[model samples]
Target: MMTAASSSGTAPFGLSVLDNALTGIGTSASEAYREVIALAQLADRRGFQRYWMSEHHAMPGASTSSPQMMLARLTGETQRIRLGAGGIMLPNHSPLLIAEQFGMLSALAPGRIDLGVGRAPGTDQATAAALRRRHDHDDRFPEQIGELVGFLEDDFPEGHPYRAVHAVPGPWQAEQNRVPHTEGLPELWTLGSSTYSAHLAARLGRPYAFALQFGRADVTSALRIYRDAFRPSPALAKPRVMVSVSVAAHDDPEEARRQTSSTAMAMLRMFQRKPYALLSPEEVAAYPATLDERRVLDMYMANTLHGTGSEVGVALERLHEQTSADEIMLVTGGHSREIQTSSVELVADHFGLPVGA
Candidate 1:
């Protein structure tokens, strides 16, 4: 369950950020990382509920391959905004290691850490093979989630084979040593773009985050399934839903649309199995796309909310009404730092989010 501290200020629904740390055609990966810090600080001061980063592997365009490392850096950069993995692709790593990493994060910023896990590989099949090295654990996602939760909670059944294994610097460690520590653990959330994840989250009674930005799943139906099938657990008493949407907003509507074109083209290239590199608006404008590619670009743009800040705000409100989501997370489109920062500020202002909080 979300605490008042984490959910405050945004009254009707919480507003948060999900960053991919995308590098533009001319930008370096280091610069992209620095921008991420700046954005986190800006979001922290502007009162966004949470600042989360996604994990992707072998994507030259996306620099956030290790969300844990970035979040560790954020523990000192921001004072209030919650820091989290928008999601960690769990099949690529050990559940025990993730437990330890997040446990350390909890120690660094108690009551301000979120661990959202997904079943996807977050990479191509070849890269997934390279990461797991013949494990092929995608089908074992549910069991891995269970093992992760058990490690975090330190409550594995006595007969379990791994019952003796404990994640150090975790709850179990603190209790065993009677060490004085902070009062909270990393809040676990389930991330998905389908009803399967919704059902799993419901059965486990964890918060659910639907990735509407993926544009491949029905958000409304998945959220409904989650709510209808929810069963309370010790971690959460009722269903909590967060919907993430792609957005590009600015004071000037045309600039907003232009900003979205870069990401739209990037999505188009991704569909073509080409390198998913974010191009500048100028480059996107000069590209000669085929009819089929144009269709894909148009479809991508149609799914993204783009316009003036007020227009985007209204669209988000409509989405909230449609999905009855407890939180709305913005995955800002485009790779321009100025546009990204401006969109967040403008939308924050439109929503009347308190500043300097």
Candidate 2:
């Protein structure tokens, strides 16, 4: 039977930010990226623990297809806050390539870089197949992960097939005979919303971040599995849990509702395989909601934290306590850039996070 960590009164938790780089109704992809950069800078300055970007392909509303590429740009622009791939979707790329990419990032940002990896394709089946033939996949995600860590740590055994392969400009440079000692590696994290990834994380002894933003997962049960099964690895001595939640917060209750509604409609369209346009609140208003649409929207948003400052804060705090999370990762909706930014600030303030680095 699954068991949760007992929660005591006034449990403390760190707060972080996750962005999809969402495109507003009238905004260009470039604009979305600009917003993302600004948001990251703000999050960094505001003393948020980490600023992570998600990866999604073929989604017209999201601009973060390559989180490493985005991190390359972000590391130069922000300071202090950890910059990470809310996940890189490991199945999409080669382990050597990922190690090299993150090794380069760690070189650039050093201790501020985090590599949160996940197994999902982060896109539709057709787009996933387009990325590389589906048959080419090994379903050996765990093996790939081990290989990735090996490359990053330059730890393959002597005479092993991959022993000499190192993330170039990484810790080692292999010549005909010699290799240099290296100590560069990004903080690694395993991300998933299911018990499968939790089990892997526990076995591997890596930090785990649960993506509750869109997952139909029981956060408490997932956390229970992770904490109960954790074993110490070089990366971590104790299990660290981060619960990622969707939030649409505003001082104006109606404004928050409008933003939440727009996001719900956009999600509904995507689920129905229809146009996934993220409309403005006014545009969304023009379309009448059918009973079925409303029902689906309500069900989809059943776990979303929506309301004024105090209202959402209470729920977030409760969630943090219930999951016994080490941190809370907040992914705000694109009600608009202003609302999104403010929502982050609002939550930060609610949780009494340090302001202005």
Candidate 3:
């Protein structure tokens, strides 16, 4: 049930967006990039708090192989919304490089950049090996995170090996070069779907984003673990939790369900190790799915929030109440650009977000 405040055109929690820049079966990568830019501008103008892009590799369905590059593009297109990597897979790249890239982004849009780091590869084993050339880096995710933070903050111990290695365009570099910079460092957030990330984020006292859209872990347990073990640090004084949810909302409930079906079919294909490109709703309806595939689609749809705008709004309200999350980041589910943009507009209207000039 929605609370009085929520029903009265004010949400109980902050609303944000997580875009994967998905390319559908009939759509080109160029089209996907255009749609992402449009959607990000729309979110910025509609008062959404953040507009974050995901990082994926060797996936035709997702065009955001480098979320930092996409964020760089968004820095010029967007004005108010926070641009971020929803997140960067730390195992695939060097922390110093990530720090340099995001540090430049922070300089471009001071106080509006977020760097969310994750442990997952964001690709299959073969592609991961192609990217990292090593399989053991996943086990060193925590160490990588510390190194990244150290690079961004330039706080490695005096005896540390990287103490002499300053990330260019970073805080330390700016200070050392006597550059008069007003740019703030990118705000760091830890992304995860399990308690391992929750525990690590808590111990490090960074903001935790639990990706319920991708992971099967219980959101409540993960959030509770994070909060319970959280320690105050300079980055954060209290636990901050953001939950990402898959949603498809339309004026017509049936249309919303149809749009959701496309995403479910994509997930089914991904589970089968097939190409993960999204198919159109018409294609999804025509395809003959196997029994197991049908079961998987059913399970995905059951977990997804799909309905008319009001229905989705109510569901979001209930989720906010249940999790007590500080923010809700919507992973809009659909293949059509129109449907996805409409979904965002509808939700924004439901929450009565003040339209930007």
Candidate 4:
């Protein structure tokens, strides 16, 4: 049987910003940022609680090179939905800088901001080196994460000399009073694709969000670890978990697949470094494929929850029932603008969720 919290109700569903992966369909980054803006607006209307952007640097496939800048931009465009990074790769910068940047964002957006952290570079090795200068080491992540948590919290205790330092400027200018350095500090979630993250999040008494879109095999194991090791915090009296799933919304399965082709191809190319393009309906119909490509296609199609509007609804409810996820964080790779805008609305309506006017 699922845990009590899992069976009680469907938790708030949210969105993850993959940016250009939706706009270019396979082409470029120029339109991707705009597509993200549009999705953020739609998600707010659709009652999705939060929108997260993953920190991916120098990855030609993703447009979110800077989640903080995107968060600030979204805060101006969106009114209610929480804005945060799916994760900030912790080892890339000092804990103090992250504290200040997020602190400033929380100050600006108030109650609608969140901070989800992860240890991986969120990119390739070369890309990590470009971001971290000489400290391109993998083992430093755990230490960096500890320091990051320390920098965000105010009371560092008397013996912790490092706590005396203010991450954001001075006391007079810090405006700790205005920023609720304590209360205004956004809700924190640990994004993990494995059991290690689940254990850490549980030990830390914070929520854990699974990146199931890529780590499909490890989802169950990770969830089990989190539940077993969970310790309650003031923020959470019980363990809270979120699963990230791929979504492709449409009334027809064939139509949805056609719409998702370039997206699938783009993801494949990200791994294979092959050339791809945004295919037209006829092109999608005419597109050729190899057995290996077809296998990749099968994996993508199986993992993604896509189909007719009602079909998606049933699948989402089932996913929630089986996993008891506190929230469903939907990640869609829209090959065009139309899908980008309509998909979230389609999901919301099918679930009987209110779309704000």
Candidate 5:
């Protein structure tokens, strides 16, 4: 498969943000989502390339589980920036559903929709079973991807069962006065943390986004695999990559550490199957952490973007140099909304992204 040509429009580097919509210790889910919308709006104004949300299920700390619904909601409120799921867990739902959802979103927002798909279920086995209702669909991911893109473009080949199925609100024509987007369908990307996914995205020739935020895989090697294996497709002529990283940006290193503690703790707890709302900085400070607990936390947080804005900018620059990533999407949040918003503003400002719109 082929990919579209290089999409570097103007900027030397692309900056984006990922919001987990963490439920602060004292805040309710409703309030937390409201804060997520605010954060998305801020990123929109700050000129981030895309505002992507992660999908997590059955987690008390993370609220975003329905990326399609969130994309629809954010589309109306946001004016310019692209709104999308960081990577919708493809195995959790039917490709037709995803195609239809994103089709409607593309209709609603026109040029501001992105569809990044991942093979992970984004939840525990029990929760994944509940969502998928079956334990045998994981192997169908590649076929599902083809079905999804086929539905979106109405490009199914003859003898295909889904050939006659037209995704509702399929590609729309631009109004007479409003100029239309040449690439009418939502921008498609393959998201992953390993060379397997990178190779898949490369072979498919679509844009690739590497998830370094929670993944322990070798980012540099994964990206190199993507680029080295890429074959031109109708959708893309050159390989493009996006690398997402965990970020905790603040002026003081100690402050940064404190701010990121809640997230670090939450990650461990989630893995331990003991999810809880985000802890406050005070709670994290006073909580009794055993030596073993402290060691685990340290190991869990060993690879993160923790530093001031300028420092983070330098780190991202080095990453760009190392991976040749076209965009750097910062997955920042956990302790509080203020910290999340500030990190977004800081990264935007440091990157010299267009702001004040």
Candidate 6:
């Protein structure tokens, strides 16, 4: 029988700290930045392959509303871990700005930066309006992706130069510096909750990271589509698929539940309102698990691989065998930095990965 340790190929796993849990501790934005810095530092020392932040606007639960800025800061703070956005919501900003910001980050961090793009607006209609009023047609993500790709590749037409040439932190500097991005541009990935992203990743020949932490009921279907549709581009020799799983770990199961309760409740509330802060363990235990909470928990348990070291090892092993995913990206949401850090440590040790406290 195949044990958890030897069930799949030993591909490196990455740590994705998206929707990180620093907000509920009364940590201000600056403090949250520091906390993320700490997490990145720890992850780097832990031998995790990458540390990705995510983009969300007007959400009290997450601080990565500006992934570009956070990337720069994380670049300055950490040493080895590949740092980038788990995804930058493309509709929220201009592709040129995305290019510029990531271009600068690539220049600074050189080989250590990545820029994952997603098509979702990352917010509701009203908030989306607040971000880019009257420019409501930003759903043109496929077109926008082409524009961003063109800017990065410097493949824009060079006719009489009639167009205002929308290239920010243009390719000249990046090319000159010998930055090694995805396809010599930037290390890019596509984030999706459905088969759309999977098909896109396969078609584009870039790696795809599924946001299963907040995904719907079609995650397995999405992954199947991605793997089947994957086409090898010059950048990738074969298909690379990563699935995101929610994580909450401690030495004991009860302790793990205690640690995860607040975040669990927060996820429960998301069905009605936007994602918000981590709740207290006491508070989470006090609230009766509603039908919505139970439903969310069922969904979460189905998609997420959680527990202490041994249990998570088994779960991860089963996931690797089941999905054949190239990599597993864990979304650690907790109310305390200690729990957040501990979650990564548990996952690391179970995989025989070099771990740090």
Query: Which number leads on lDDT?
Result: 3
Those runs of model 5 whose alpha carbons end farther than 4 Å from true positions after fitting are 1-11, 172-183, 290-292
lDDT (Cα, tens digit) per residue for candidate 2, span 221-274: 778899999999988999998889988888897898888777777788888876
lDDT of candidate 3 over 1-357, digit per residue (tens)? 122235555666888999999887888989988999999999999888899998998887889899998899999999988999989999889999999999899988999999999989898888988895467887888999999999998889989999999987877877888986578889899999998999999999999999988735688899999999999999999999899999988999999999888889888888888878788889999998888878988888877888988898899999988999889988986888777897888888788776667
For candidate 6, list the clashing residue pairs, or say none. 182-186, 182-187
Candidate 5 lDDT over 1-357, as tens digits, reads: 111111232335578888878887777889888988898899888777899987889888888888778778888889988988887888887888888888788878988899889988787888887885466676887888998888788788899998777777674223333654453688999999988898899999999999987737798788888889999999999999888988888767677777788888887777677864578878877978889888767865666777787777778777777787788888987577777887887766676765665
User: RMSD to native for every prediction?
Assistant: 2.7, 4.0, 2.2, 4.0, 4.5, 3.9
Model 5 residue pairs with clashes: 2-232, 2-233, 3-233, 3-235, 3-236, 3-237, 4-235, 4-236, 4-237, 5-237
Q: Count clashes in each candidate, considering only residues at least 3 apart in sequence or on different chains.
A: 0, 0, 0, 0, 10, 2
Query: Can you give the TM-score per candidate against the true fold?
Result: 0.95, 0.91, 0.96, 0.86, 0.91, 0.87
How well does candidate 5 score on lDDT at residue 225?
Answer: 88
Q: Which structure among the candidates has the greatest TM-score?
A: 3
Off by over 4 Å in 1: 1-11, 133-135, 180-183
- Model 4 spans > 4 angstroms off: 1-21, 25-28, 133-137, 159-161, 169-183, 273-288
- Model 5 / residue 290 / CA error / Å: 4.2
Q: Candidate 2: which stretches are off by over 4 Å?
A: 1-11, 133-138, 174-183
- The models' CA-based lDDT, in order, is 0.87, 0.81, 0.87, 0.71, 0.80, 0.71
Q: Sort by TM-score, best first: what order? A: 3, 1, 2, 5, 6, 4
Model 1: lowest-lDDT 10 consecutive positions: 1-10
Candidate order by decreasing lDDT:
3, 1, 2, 5, 6, 4
* Candidate 3 Cα lDDT to native: 0.87
Q: What are the per-residue Cα lDDT tens digits for candidate 4 across 222-301?
A: 89889999988777889888888877787667777766765666566656755334555455456587889777866866
Q: Kindly report which residue pairs in candidate 3 clash with one another.
A: none
